[model samples]
Target: MRLTGPVLLVASLTLGLGCSAAQAAESGSSSPTPSTTVTIPPDTTDSGGLSPEEVQRQVARAEILRQQILATSDDMAAAMTKVEEAAKKANAALQAYSEASTEGRDAREKAKTQADIADALQERLDQARSELREWAVSAYTQGGPLAEQLGYLDALSKEASEASNPLQDLNYLTDNRIRSVDDIRQVAVAQKLASMNAEAELGKAEAAEAKAKKAKLKAQGFVQQQQSALDELRTAHAEHVTEAGPLAGLLLGTGDADAIAASERLTDALAASNVSIKDLRLTPCTDASGVFPNGQIPPSNLCPMVGSSDEFLVPDAAAAFNAMSKAYAKDSGQLLCVTDGYRSYAEQVAVKAARGPWAATPGTSEHGLGRAVDLCGGVQDYSAPAHLWLVQNAALFGWFHPDWAAQGGRLPEPWHWEYAG
Candidate 1:
């Protein structure tokens, strides 16, 4: 039925609805409505078209991606911190190496300086040893105690070289070695003094030897000179004795035995008259020319007492008297008179009794030896010009007057001399 009117239509729709329901019953209730139109707007939330469970799963996945990004940033920050720490460590090592290098260089320089000082000390020691050796050798050559002492010093030097401690070595050199050096100096000074003294002694010895030699030579020369003088005197004496032989016999009355006998018999008359006579009396009365006699009484014969005969004096006495007389005459035009010559032993006894012991005994008298003479001036005054002339020139005839105190029994007689020859 075609439902046209409203009531009619209602009745038809009911019928149709019943048929559609039978047909909808035949299809599944889960099928999509084809005649119904369902419309939806665009989704504003992040779930888009998903269900609640799907929306929840998408939120969880997004949360996981955010956690991964955070973890990566943390790793990068850790790497940066590690790089800063490494840089700091490298800087600290460089600073430590620089300090170590500087200290090592200083140590090396110090060691070098100490070595140089040690070397200098060694050289000084060596030089000192050499000098000591030389000095020791010289002392040994000289031969004495100094040589022995120097040997000891050399040994000490060698011992000092082997010492380990530097300070100990220095102490040995200063106190012991230097002291030894001082000792050597003192010895040298002492030796010099001794040498000077020895030289002085040697000089004195040489001078003494020279002086002794000179004295010996002078004494020898004097002896030779005296020998010549003695020879000349002896020759002159011999010549005088030979020339007076004849005169001596005439004076002694040897040529007239009768006259001599008569004279002997007139002894008392001669003695009473105090006639002066030599031991050998002259025959008759005579002067130099034997032609005159003086009447005046003669003095006592002192010559006979002395034991000397005029004959003993003979020519020597005559020659000497004549020579003196000639010199006196030539110089002063005056004559020298001879008053006495020699005497006998009896005469000396008489003189001794009269003049005391100062006179010589008979034989000991110089007059007995015929070596004496007594002279007189022809005029008065024994100090006359002729007497003075005789005194000045008598020594030329080898004559000398004894001193006044030595004249036996006579007073000082300036005109007397003994022939020294």
Candidate 2:
């Protein structure tokens, strides 16, 4: 069956849920969801094919896909609800139609029986009239209209002339007239009841059948629309996944930080001012991965560092380290080995478990703040060539061999290095 106007509109809107950079479905409206613009940082020149604009573009694209997924989810839920409601209505209508059909069938059968009874009563009344007509004619032939319209006694005598008893003659005449009139009245009443039962019941049955058919059609149309929506949703998700890889650097950074400082700043600002999110201050993300658990850590001075490890350091330190590493690699024909660079709180706990008393407690470690590294060359022995080179010329690179780590100092660690930057 053909779909109605309102059902067609729902189908069209379900098909229109796609956007250029985003996807959203407006209930009862066919307008498209608009794309949002974001300003990304300029390229850091050395980023491995991941320029700021490229990253931001990818992020915005992903956001659009995210919106579509959410919209589709809502669409799926609503479709299911519509189908359910439609099914419910259809079931009720079908039940009503069934009841009406049965009632109509029973009513028709009763009407047919009443019609037969009415015919029989009519035949008997006709026979009684014929008998009376003969008597009326006899009365007119014997006398005239005057004699025919005379006393009941005279009429009775003519009707029951062959009766042996006078009382019997009168009783026979009276009974015939009374019984014939009652039969005529019964036939008319029965005919009227039969017509009411057949005609009224037939109309009800037809109307109920039409209502049930309409409800069934509506449910079927909704199911078809839902299936089409599901197909579109799957295709959109595949495209979203295919394009999300450009949002990060060449590699994912393992650096992790507590974000306590940023959290504290957020709390303090909220106490001082009403701290509207639209005008909130942000700190550069402390994590090398450039991600916070949620959007909870707003954007701050993010110093993305470019290197083979794909790690980010504090901005000044990361730039200086990059320069220093390039110089060092130039001289030695290989970069300095890093056993560990930045450690998240969880990583610190793991390291502490593996190296008792040697690993700093989680929050106290400088690595959590993206400022420390542990060297793996013979630098751990304090006498490696890599350490010797840094001792003499590392000052120019903003790196230093700290005093606390010097020989004979308390808790001396030969492999540790901190960036002054």
Candidate 3:
């Protein structure tokens, strides 16, 4: 029987015989041959019914493919670095936009307050001038200052006849007329200053609004650039997968012992780079239309995990998580349990409503970006063995507990983890 793919890896490594056991079995042996009883095959012999020259060529081809895979891995690493830089730029732009927007709002409120103060001052100046004009008209009608003063006093006494304190009202009216006439020029100057200040504040508010709009546009441009970089990276990955897939198939299907050995080496190298044969068969996520602003990514745009929980994440993150989960299972004798992954926009809205301040706002969560997960099965407790193990090793798989989820954080959550890539 011809073994293939991962089973070949297991059979060779688990038995510690490489492909020799399979070779021996194919030779029509009745029972398993002991190492002591084994005889060396001829140097000219090649297993899988191939000539020695053909086997050598297959082995050479496999080595070439392995080298190509390493080159592709380097390309991917470079691409990932670019993606990270783009993300940083995008974040900086967003922060600028947020600060500009806040300043714009504050400036607008300041302008409104200043305008209201200016309007009140203008009204006060008008009222003072109107009273001064009436006083002047009374002085002209009465024919002299002394006569006008006596006339005003008589008018006031008539108005205060029903007052609770007629003497006090008369005294206040006499003091107010002198102060109003003296303060008229000061009120006019104050209103002019206020109007000028209001205009300045209005100009500042408009400038702030323009700055906010520019910041928003810059932030949007950065986001689009980041998305384009990601798309390019995905395209490069798909191309590499296409090239590596057939090479792997050609090497493994040949069943030549030397070729199989070389194929196994290629597999090991792929694993070392956090890649798998299955990756070569996966559908690339290329369509990112309408799946931005966090969350709202379609299922077809993400990679689904193996568990029944229906958890999913972005392609690179999902692959890392899968590799990490497998390692955890091997070391701990149990699969890593995930409580949450890749939240849709609608799901995020529901989560926000249900959890209130404990949950991130909709469209702003890292989970919405398909790079975070909430894990359980002893991983939720900071003191648990599983959590301890993760602390020691998760970063090796590109998963990390963010500082916000660390102990003593503002809202510590030991279960939350995110993919760095």
Candidate 4:
């Protein structure tokens, strides 16, 4: 009855339906609806039971992804725009050619225009093909079937494969995998469809290119060149339909690869763990020790980290931190001294009262998120070996020292590090 979360989405990936059909199916069925369709719901909809802020955040994220994709593909995207221009020119040329073939009115001038447009189109087709081919080859060679890169035939093949089976090489599915599968499958499908359209366009362009060459040689049937150009333009329009959708926001490359991988891992970990916004809201900042006024702290979603810190952290973040700690000890033969971990609102208030503004504000404290930790021993010193090692290695595990907490930072606390998970 609740048409929220990943159900309708996964159904869409698995079934492939229009947004309206999917919604209709979701609203109609009480049983698990294996509906087809993944319409992007409004960013903020009371129907989905999500707050406006959550919708805004989702939209913001999509916007950021779109920007990143376009930023990386600026040159290629610009080249692709020429396809549209070429399509327009081809239409014009075809009209001129048609007029030339008409009963007789100095047809030479119109024929010349058609030939000229064909020449321009051939040049553009060559450039677009070359650019796309390069990017596709790079993605295929580097990522194999898993690469998300969009380019030429390689991008096509990968999109098709990924669209169908995103979990191909992975061993098992996490909660995130199950829930995210549909949302991502839709993206992959959109990409796959786009690639198919592009393939068709490329084929038409190649054919037109050949015809254009012949026209140049004989300069005879300008009328034939006009027909070929018209056909290519039609294909370009079809390709544009796919292009105007998902590919605009998706980028497949290694530049942000680590961040992407970490995000997936974190999502899985969050799903598998017993963590929820509600549970976090119920947790106290610290065990009551009467160290602060009223001993009451804002509730937080903090879970205990494994192996070392008894300090609580948000579930996945704690896991990442623990993993980092293990690797750190193996590399350096020492355990980090954790003098402090998750702090309640009350605890933050107490610490700040004692330390003044030198401490982060209570609600603003990273410790409140259960992702911040305070180290003791030599690790707290900016020049200490432990701190130096952490700076070099922690990012590998999705942990980082905040710029504000680093040496020469506004606060300059070398003892602090936060899990980015």
Candidate 5:
């Protein structure tokens, strides 16, 4: 011991200084000093030769790197979720826009259909109005006072064209307006033209009836005008003939003057009888003037008694026939028909011989008495109304139908009536 205190003090200083150096190194303030005798152990597998503070620093750095990795993973997840949400939103928007476009197209198609219907309706209305106008013009030309009425019809047709439908508009017109205007116009120009033709036919029928009535009236007037002239001629002839019959009887010596006067009286009585003679004539038997003073001969050879020097009816029996006709006419509005008034005795004899048993002998025939007359009604047929009237009424005229039943070998003669005179 070199002096124990000095030695102890130095050792203590050295140790303290060594410890101070180590602390400085640990604190990273300075490097460690190399020592030959002091052995530092080689770094082993179990322990990295690091201080406690360094280890704690290394652990903190590793923790920080792991936290960085976790943060990156969280960020990636968030980004993927955002991309998926955005894609769903875009698809939804696309679907909505497509539906809206389809609805718009459908609405446009419906509008086009409505427009087409409106166009067709308008065309029909125009055609109907044009036809109506043509009809109105035709009615005006047919010469009625309906020209102004036709103008009104044209106005109505214009109004109808303005309407949405013309056929429906036709119902709005009144009955008289339709008949006098629209109906008349359509018929006037129709294919058959039946309405106008019917009116013309009616007019013709009325004119024909008027003409027939006028002709009938003219015929009746002519018949009435001639009645008086016929009556005057008949009266004059009867007076002149009455004086000749008896003078002829005296000249022929068939009777005395008194006898002739008596016969004359009988003739006068017969003339005065209730009879109507439509016509009568007398002629002398001959042209010998002095043979009978009052006798007047007819100036013709047609009389059968013209050569006889005696007075006679022109056919020798005309006086009795005249008297008979007068009686019949006085009792009825009808006149007798002298279908066969007189016959010469020779002619009668010739007829009898020609007809054999069917004809009467000359003097025996009732026709020689000149009391029979035939009759005819105004018409041609011999039907019941005329025949029954004659049968029921002829007896009041002092006339009888000798052939009432067609008996006694005589033909039925509906017109034959004999005066009892």
Candidate 6:
């Protein structure tokens, strides 16, 4: 019924989950889920006053609890991924909409310009036709040019009264009539060309207008898509908060006091969880109403550490440690082994029970808050190559050996390191 070392640590991380499952079992439910709303016990610390016996009972089911936590973590991670994808799509959609809208506006403007040109051309055509009509009317009212010339010639011949030759006068009048007709014919030709140009321009204008309308519709569709994506992102995030919060609370202690005690733990957990520090960021509670005893922060608040199933830390520290570990691995052909991170008050108690004086008092340890980690592999030995390498390179990643863990310090532990940031 008892597990040791990593198994025990892993199990301890899921104590809250195990308790919830136990409740569900009692209620005859085949599946159990953590409560979104955690009722703060009268004593937020002291592990909700769980007796040593009850704690052991939960520890007996550590593997099961660990699996449950992992499953929930995976689900939350998927939801988070969806949210990210949705956000990206939404951004792209918005960009498309902006471009489409701009194009639509330009198209409409061009259409208007073309239409105006067509209108101007039509006006010119109308004026040309009116001038031609006026000339015809004047000719008709004057008894027509040919008829008047004939009449004048007849009168001259009949009178026999000498003037210039009649044929010559008739010829001169004919020449004047031909010149006037030529002028009118030229105007009509020019008007016809203008009308053709105007009609083409109008066609172009209509096409442009149609294009503008299509672009506007497309832009609207994209905008709507972007809005829908935003809504999905919000929903996904809310679900993440609902499901992961309690799990994080169980992994690390919650409430203001535990938060203060485990401030580093919280930072590291947030980092590892991949939650934005600003969004799910935790500040130590100032009032009694908000204090959660050890292992009280929501799972949503803590991040899973790299290369660690049960371990969690703040984002920056987790990133740095992973980087450091990768660098170490590149040099040594093996990853830096991690044994523990982000201890809850309950886990702190268990560790104390198991390791006695070696463990910090419950609720007082950095492991409870998530900023510290205990290493394995050769790093545990001061003279080990891993330890020497860390001494030379770990500080580059904001991780360093504390004075207490130095060779000449109060309790030299080569494997114990804390995140500076």
The candidate, 2 or 5, that scores higher on TM-score is 2
State each model's CA lDDT, in order.
0.42, 0.49, 0.67, 0.48, 0.40, 0.56
Query: By lDDT, is 3 or 5 better?
Result: 3
lDDT of 3 by residue, 1-421 (tens): 3344544554344334424544664565566557535454554233433446766776787688678768877876776576556555554554455456556756767778878887898898899899788877765786435754575566667655543454564577667777887798787788788778777877887887788788667756655664565566567555545555444544555556666678677666555454222121233234333435579777767886545358898887787788777767767777788889999899999999999999999988889988889999999999999997677546444466765677898889999987754
Q: lDDT per residue, candidate 5, 1-421, as tens digits?
A: 0222322344355345545654454555244465323333332111233333443443343344334334533543454344334333322332233233334434444445544544554555456556666666655776333654565566666765563443343444434446546554543345234333444444444454454444334433332333333344345435333432322222112122333343344334323321234333333233432211111223242222222223233332333333333544554444434344334466568868897875567765544443344445521123544444444333322334554323242565665544432
Rank order by lDDT, top first? 3, 6, 2, 4, 1, 5
Give candidate 1's total backbone clashes.
15
lDDT of model 4 at position 136: 54
TM-score of each: 0.25, 0.32, 0.49, 0.30, 0.21, 0.34
| Best-matching candidate per lDDT | 3
> Can you give the lDDT of residue 404 in candidate 4?
70
Best by the TM-score measure: 3
Query: Per-residue lDDT of 200-247 in model 2, one digit per residue for the tens?
Result: 655655665565455445434543443344455445444433332221
Q: Is candidate 1 or 4 superior in lDDT?
A: 4
Better structure of 1 and 2 per lDDT: 2
Off by over 4 Å in 3: 1-59, 144-178, 221-225, 272-421
Model 2 RMSD vs true structure: 37.3
lDDT of 1 by residue, 1-421 (tens): 1212332343345345434544554454566577854343223122222334543443343334334334433543454344334323322332233234334434444545544554554555556667777756764776424644455556576656563554554466447647667655655555455445445544544554454444334433333333333344344333323322222222123213332232232222222222111111122122322111111113221212112233234344445545555555555554555555665566667767887865666566655545565555542244566654444345433344555522252565555556532
Against the hidden true structure, what lDDT does model 1 obtain? 0.42
lDDT of 1 at 200: 53
